[model samples]
Target: MSNSQFSEERFQQAPVVGILRGVDHATLDRIIPIYINAGFSTIEITMNTEGATNMIQKLSEEYPQLNVGAGTVCDMDDLEEALKYGAQFIVTPITNEAIIRKCKSLNIPVFPGALTPTEIYKAWTAGATAVKVFPSSQFGIGYIKDVMAPLNKIPLLPTGGVTLENIADFFQAGVTGVGMGSSLFPKQFLKEGFEQQLFDHLKAVKSAYESVFQTA
Candidate 1:
């Protein structure tokens, strides 16, 4: 699929972007199916990961059902490399206007990280699909709520310190989506080779998200 074809509708079905960082190819191969099976629609492989470009290419081709993206894109070179390898979306840890503009020109969905109001507004004005509030754990859900009060027009995707327990609460606070990393896929499970436990955890997370939207 083309990079411009990111499905916002499909993403809203789950609205959780699973982040993979420093994961080896073998581990990625083992866990992707589990992630997909647990009802995730979006996943990003950080550019800093070893062989990230290759992994993006392979996953994009292998899992057409998944919205394969590249994260940790801090500069123009990283953006070029990600696009060259079929990254359907782009994510950054900082608000890089050049990278955001490039992704915007290509019509690829981009989420640039920001914290303060100034940075967030700057990223939104630069044409980011959504501004990611990085290290959100530092301020917690109340911070997201306060930011949304005035900047309600800007879509926010909070990353860092997100967990199944608080995922629903984040949505309630008016976030467009949430990005999860080690919280969703615990390092302990991966290190110990507890595949079944990890799969179960993902399923539980999905259930928790769905519960928030379920009709009474």
Candidate 2:
């Protein structure tokens, strides 16, 4: 897939990256449509997930409208596998300069995870499209605000602990976007076949996002 397929403008329009981790293929088949229909534009399948590359290729072909990406890419092999399988974007849980440089060389959008101010700045200087403030839960919203106080130019995509209630708060704290997993796609809802409830949940997230960015 061409790097051009990952549109920064589109992502900025609805800056929520739906994370699919450890979800089976059958479940993916059911919920992908719901996710898209609920107004999400970006989704990532973790590389550690079983059959992740295949799922990435399948989703890329099936849902061309959604910006499909690879997450949890820890090494060069993981990065190569992700790119080979048609990942439009790449997300790493740790800041790796080589990976960031490779993605930048390919013109692919890369979000490298970093916790401390030093790591975040290093990731940004290394050509990361955005620095993913992972485990944002541990430090909370105030941490993000503090991080942005000095590094305001670096785009930050906070992952983890992002919920419907505080999704807007994260944005208000100066996050370019957020990555959500269990909080956004509860396994219980999927197991119980609560598709409508899940849909409503996603809609609420979208509404919450718009509430901050005024995309409504």
Candidate 3:
């Protein structure tokens, strides 16, 4: 197993990391394979998603080829739970030096959130696999591009507000990858009446991403 230390060699090959935020056990059972089938080798189930740790353990056990990561992990307890659940990577909405060091102690890759150059650099020096530029919608892709100019050595993952139309724009602006939420997963999927629409959204987002980021 590659484990979630997110080694450079493995991460390079993993172009997209699917951020699954609104899943339950049944939803996970249905949705995880969809990402894998769409050529996404990495999947992140946020703590906001119900049964995150249990789902992580289940999905990791079932999908040996796909690397699994935990998102919205806020504390040492979450880190410990993630490790116990066999998560391969850890993600947070904000940078926490303690979480970073704790994950390092267990050899798990930690990608913390940051909005400014100072925070990004601090996260990097703290040993994050990459820094997640959260709420990219509000910050804009250009801001991220600008941030990368001075801190080019740090790898950035832009979450929130990156869509199929602008996903490549983020890449062009310069980000290692994007972590998408509602834009990829629509409201109908959560409701009972629109399963087929969910399928369409999945294919549309995946296809659009393929068209937009062939290099990925």
Candidate 3, 97-149: lDDT as tens digits: 99998777777878899888899999999988889988788988789889988
Model 1 scores a C-alpha lDDT of: 0.91
TM-score-best of 2 and 3: 2
Model 2 residue 154 CA deviation in Å: 0.7
The C-alpha lDDT values of all candidates are 0.91, 0.91, 0.78
Residue 141 displacement (Å), model 1? 0.2
Overlapping backbone residue pairs in candidate 2 total: 0
Clashing pairs in 3: 4-88
The numbered model that scores best in TM-score is 2
| Worst-scoring 10-residue span by lDDT in model 1 | 1-10
Kindly list the per-residue Cα lDDT of model 2 for residues 21-45, writing each as its tens digit: 9989989998999998998989999
lDDT of 3: 0.78
Q: Give the TM-score of candidate 3.
A: 0.87
Candidate order by TM-score, highest to lowest?
2, 1, 3
